[model samples]
Target: MVENKHVLEISSVTTSDRGVYTCKASNRFGADICQAEMAIIDKPHFIKVVKGTNTVLQCEVAGTGPFEISWYKDKKQIRSSKKYRLTSQKAVISLEVSSFNSADVGEYECVIANEVGKCMCSATYILKDWQTPLIS
Candidate 1:
């Protein structure tokens, strides 16, 4: 008689880790097999924006739906209003600011979650001067 066992583990999964996986066991008598698809819960990342201007801060994410996205500034939750507009399209989420001012400079975080898991990413917004380039 013979016995065998196996296990697979993945840490810090990303979009590149998504794919189909198969496991098979065979012996002199016969063979048994099993398969499953690995899906990743990707973390959000900010997209590049124009400097020293009223620009939209966008982040892209990829994973299984339905996904819920939330925005925060300096650890405080942000809501859509005249000064800020939030939009989500497929895997992309964005926050549009009406104007760039000193008050807007802070840490901005994007949180994305689904039934499987949740992940978040943040960027620091800094303004040197109106003429100076924007940094985030």
Candidate 2:
């Protein structure tokens, strides 16, 4: 008699690992085949932003379909207004702050989720005051 059950496991899957896989079982009497497809959901990743008088933060994410993106400051949800502008283009997500200052210094986070999974990345905003040199 042939065993009628099987299992497949994958760990730390990457984009290259996504593809179709086939399983086949055979016996002297007959044979059977089955196929499955593997899909990957990439976690959110922050892109390096240049710091200046104004502040902008951005992240990139990839996955299958209809993603919900949200931004948070110090664990509280934020929305676009005169003070903040949120935008999404293709896989890139961004937040722009108009006239960033000491008041805006805190932990900023971007959360992305889909039917399959959820992921987030965060960054801290720190303000530094510039000092002028005194010449005698």
lDDT of 1 by residue, 1-136 (tens): 6755688888877688889999998889999899999867554443433222345677767666788788898999999999888998876788876766778888877788877777787767777686332556
TM-score of 1: 0.60
lDDT of 2 by residue, 1-136 (tens): 9956678888877878999999998889999899999877664444443333357777766675478889998999989999989998988788887766667878888888887778887877765564321111
The regions of model 2 sitting more than 4 angstroms off are 1-53, 130-136
**Which residue pairs show collisions in model 1?**
none
User: All models: lDDT?
Assistant: 0.74, 0.75
- Which model scores highest in TM-score? 2
